[model samples]
Target: MRQTFHTSGPVLMGDQTNSQEFHLSLEQITQAPADCTLRYLDFHGTQAKLGVEYSGTAPFTRDGIKLSPAPEQAAPLQASWCVTLLSPSASLAQLQQLMRFFDGQQWTLVAADTLAQRPECTVIRFQIEGDLNFDRARLSCLRVADQLGADLVIQAAATQRVPALAGFDMDSTLIDAEVIDELAKITGIGDQVTAITQATMAGDMDFCESFKRRMALLKGFSEKRLAEIAQELPLKEGAYELLTALRALGCKTALLSGGFTYFAEFLRRERLPLDFTYANELKFAEGALTGEVVEPIIDGDRKRKLLTEIAEKLNISLERVVAMGDGANDIPMLNLGELGIAIHPKPKVRMQAPQAINLFGLDAALYLFGLNDRQIEKLG
Candidate 1:
């Protein structure tokens, strides 16, 4: 039994016992392959993916031959790409020559991404068979893939970068407690607020109208307590870095939340380039829950309205904007943008988003613009 592993990570040079480590960058000059994967690598080759044979965890085999990770008796510290020879009957010497041609400088490989795949491709697919960590192994695979003339199909991971607008969901996205629910908590009507919230987000209730209903329940929360809870909200991970990067890129940012303005403004005060923000306002009278909310609350429709309004105000196209959220409330706003990428969205939310980022941190949104690892390092 044999298996092919593709991975991408830090570069390895020479032999492990006495070798140097340096970044091995790759450049793709031609059309990519059908696909590839880094089960053991990061090179996701369209060609490889297209022809892959998965037999319920069985090793990949073609005809009667098993696809070995590496050939037996292969040289140490050597890499080879398995390309179908012009002449299937070509001698091993011809194969070696073909491999040698690609290992030369004409080809460049980075991680698992391949630069070319066709016959003009005198290039070949490279494989490095060795034991290493996932990160290390991924790098080795790409290094070998590039060295052998074939492009690594895997892409370089994104690094954080530039200023871009960030429209937030103040309630759960930016802060913890929903102001409406908290008011309910304070007024001893927590169940009422929560019930309305779930029903509204579940699409079972009309956003604005249901929101008005919740606000009516909080008609008189005190202004002092709004300040109190604002201090207690926890910012999401990498929030600062994400904001700083976006601002650096000259992004027009704002807070688009269903939560109250009370806590949203508190976040903007830390020096974020908050152009404007929108959310429902709790009608306050004294320092306690009023049991009634203000009218014309910012609901789901309001979010979509604000998205269009903001884009026009910034003198930018919706294509230049990126919105993130985890609930159904974000869908309308998301649709108005050029690329609505879901960030750790709900199952339904993820399904609707044209682009989605779930594996990396929320800041991974930076990758959508094609910034490389090195460029991202400069952002911080």
Candidate 2:
């Protein structure tokens, strides 16, 4: 997966001897080198009154604004690390402990930069110079983040790139609710259908079989009711902001779902500003659901295929495609994209995907694109 580092936090160092309390201007902090892995600079007189913590090899920021070096002072690019804290209360001590654990390992952690700053979630970039065992480091990061109730994303310097196309899983990833489950509710079989959905999405049962069973329970439901559900589809937090921002960046967006085209089409035409959408078609007869999906189900494999097709059509490399999902069915496309991000995913999805977002709104994905506080603020 394409990896980018976006970080911001107070470098809380318990070691006072090496920790120098010094004041620096925003420009000075911006011009700071990326080679220092753990440097804590107290920001004085800044509007936000926030301290500057640099842990990765990228520009530092407070909130979404970058603390950059002056025009003539930009440093040469080096290794990059992106660390995102999904939990608001994750202490620097936890990170310090992680690095200390790594201290005995092969890789050496160096300087860092802040990317996006929020109270609940923060992203930081770090520079590493060593013959490191990346796989081991990744495992350690996952373990630590899980224990600390946070998320950690690591991208080697070479893999970082801005994506040209992004494919999003619709039902749970983009919208807050599952359309099928909602339809089941209307059919008075909500509990049964919801259980099947959970199992299917958790990879316990075949999605096709589970879907067929669920749809059968919804047989004879009015198409008008489906339309009503579509009208009330609640988008996940930051869905609109992320899509709009992506469109502005000339990034083509596609909604790839195993869910019905009814709601996906509604989102494209009436709500979200997506450029393309591919989903399973629901069969209807005389303005009523026939309790069947069209042939050639848009399952996980199909989702991956569609992602590749969309990337090819846009003339974008798979290395510049970002895929987001929240279910077991999304595993294929999640692995297919250059950056596979699981948003509030199931336990199975969380363990497999390289990156995940659990603590913040969907907009935080923007940080993965290397945007800073200033750029994000301007998006408003």
Candidate 3:
């Protein structure tokens, strides 16, 4: 459908003829990347603060105002893409930066407008002037979107668990951070520590190597910090609701990760089944880190092995298990479950995950299990 957007106001979608114009927000559009091609970005027709541009044979121009001809389209001899500021997740200033990178690349583009609300995510749509080289630009666009977290559009769904066992990533998966990493945070090395955290999550680095490097960075870190961070790490959205609902349905609930125990300690305190939390250990020197890890990094392989063991012990079949994760490390388990769920996962992880929960929150995972909001509230 044709939509009209304004630089100062909101973008109008659906029936633009109507006086009732829906405004999109930067927030919705900026849910960031969903690890897919044109999934949902924000709720469809939702207002977004979008900075849109066109790059096809007919630069998306209406009355001389250019619009990007959708996401993927052919240009001329030079490959180009229609870059849009779908939302302000990255901000107008950020879009400008992207433009600067795109500038003088022998590419032509027209920045038509900006709007307020986020929009639905969709696969690439093109109105190419003609088929031309556009692969480079498209790839660049994907990378920009990923780096900015302006890569996805959230969809709509029910917030509840279906009747089934729910698997969780223990570290950042359930709570946050490895016990050792949290300990490092107390010593004021959080930024360095989190760097390893991100790489491990992104699947850019090897799990054990990454874990050890981050662990080594934590030398002189204290065990006390583990207890402290455990008490403070934020819970993923709907984590509690998910656990409660799953248990109510007699579904198995488990926490598996390549993280550590200190953070799991928090969930354990919460009194959730947690079922099982697997990860490596951080040895402490009296109170601080000893700059060494206990043998056998739990890594991805171990996580899968542990899942197998847990399934066997519980007398549950892998087909009945549901796995969720955000990084490639979790892929093994995600593939192991009957229904592997990717929760706000990275691009690679999402593409491989059997099912994805892009709407609502973690509670949305409950929906696939057959639980609804009302049912969940009843459980509460």
lDDT of 1 by residue, 1-380 (tens): 00112222122344222111111112221222212221111133332211122222212222222222321221111222221111111122323343344455343222231211221221123433322243343334345433433322211122112324556666655554466687679878899889888777656677777776776777666777677777776665545656667776678777898877766777788534466788766554556655465656666667878877887877776656667666678778766664555555555665564444433334545544433334445677
| Residue 249's lDDT in candidate 2 | 80
Minimal lDDT window, size 10, model 3: 152-161
lDDT of the candidates, in the order given = 0.48, 0.69, 0.51
TM-score of each: 0.57, 0.79, 0.57
Highest TM-score: which candidate? 2
For model 3, state the Cα shift of residue 224 in Å. 2.0
**What's the ranking of the predictions by lDDT, best on top?**
2, 3, 1
lDDT (Cα, tens digit) per residue for candidate 2, span 129-213: 6665655666677787777555676655544555799999999888999999988887788999999999999999998888788
* Candidate ranking (TM-score, best to worst): 2, 1, 3
- What are the C-alpha RMSDs, in order, of all predicted structures? 15.1, 8.1, 12.8
Error of 3 at 161 (Å): 9.3
